[model samples]
Target: MSENDTPTTVSESSETKDRPVLKLNCFLPYQLSHLAETVSRSFSKIYAEKYGIGIPEWRVIATLGEYEVVTARDVSSSTSMHKTKVSRAVAALEKRGFVARDKNPDDMREQTLRLTETGIAVYEDIIPKALAYSEGLQAALTPGQQELLNEIFNRLHQAARERDIE
Candidate 1:
């Protein structure tokens, strides 16, 4: 038989073509997600180990530090966390002496959360370190790339919000 007429080689007992192929790694997105999770977890771990606060607790403290006083619902909205989660975190922070909850004088049923002096000191001590770590993370990317990433993430956030994922 001529070269073009020769029988094609195939997998033994199978009809599939015996050719090299490219296969996408479906775990690529998962791998990226895992990395992101690890980075955040590591940040939390460092903050907790050095400052004695959990991740959610740190967020609560940070927000309360900046706002001085805000409702638990507001913290939930700002953090994109659930109301129950914020409530629980606030309770934990209050138990730790890092947060103070006071019934709003104007509305007896409404309570505002604020960081205690100790919480402010802890937040102040960690903010610079957290920012430095953030800056280090972006050191490999150009300013343009960082901006583009932020835009893409914003769009994703909007889509999630529209879909009621929040």
Candidate 2:
């Protein structure tokens, strides 16, 4: 194909436009959630690349690490993931020898999840790396700025939960 016959990409058009064909600015309060999603995607990709586990699996393992044993519903609630997603993650982790499921004594129908010894070792290895990543992320921010940002995020999250669809 001739050079002039090739189609131009949207980003190239964006740069050459007189008034920015696309406004590209985020005006809604939920826009920050998009940024958070981007950050989570990047972190998950990096962590998965390093450790060979996906984000949902990581979330399940991490949550189980914090609490010795938790129900599938509890995992879903804590991660804000759907029940099916949590179930799939639990299944994957179980296959990888990281998690074990047992009958919940209190509720015979529900299952409780726990990390295996290998899973605990994996969590111990990843926690420091995760902390270092977070520290590196906040390295450029002043302590006050960090605190303010945390407060803002918490307030926004609370508001979103209050407005959530039933």
Candidate 3:
């Protein structure tokens, strides 16, 4: 084609016409992420407002409360949170007197974390409220639906793990 003669190719309008439009509302990953965020934010309000702890801090507290003594690496692995996030949360909790750390007898570099008395009290106070919130959410579904949901979630979890292996 000569420089003077402009060439006509597939226009932007025609190219866009062939592309599939994504509906985020119906997209599985997007829907799952949105639902998880919504639930976490809603539940977090209970701890955030009452205890002044954010989600990461709450996760650390809950983990320590359950395990009694675990390292920061354990918390990160269990909660799937980054090591930096767990460390920061641990620092905040320690500052608030909610967590205590002790050097491991066998490993000087590793420290085990545990909940302080105050942390235990906060955990005790939040447990009932967390159960109530969970029950409230489950109440929206029938018993059969709840059972089916459990099964569906288990299957999805397994599928994700299997996919990871592949």
In model 3, the Cα lDDT at residue 115 comes to 96
Model 1 misplacement above 4 A? 1-36
Q: Model 3: per-residue lDDT, tens digit, 1-166? A: 5323434556745854888655556677777788888899999999999889999999999899889999999999999899999999999999999999999887999999999999999999998999899999999999999999999999987887888853
TM-score of 2: 0.80
| TM-score to true structure, per model | 0.75, 0.80, 0.85
RMSD, one per candidate, in order: 9.9, 6.2, 9.3
- How are the candidates ranked when ordered by TM-score, highest leading? 3, 2, 1
Winner of 1 and 3 under lDDT: 3
What's the CA error at residue 134 for candidate 3, in Å?
Answer: 0.5
lDDT of 1 by residue, 11-100 (tens): 533543555443223344554566677778878865888766777788898788778989998899888778988888888888878899
Q: Give the worst 10-residue stretch by lDDT in candidate 1.
A: 20-29
Q: RMSD of candidate 1 to the true fold?
A: 9.9
lDDT of each: 0.79, 0.84, 0.90
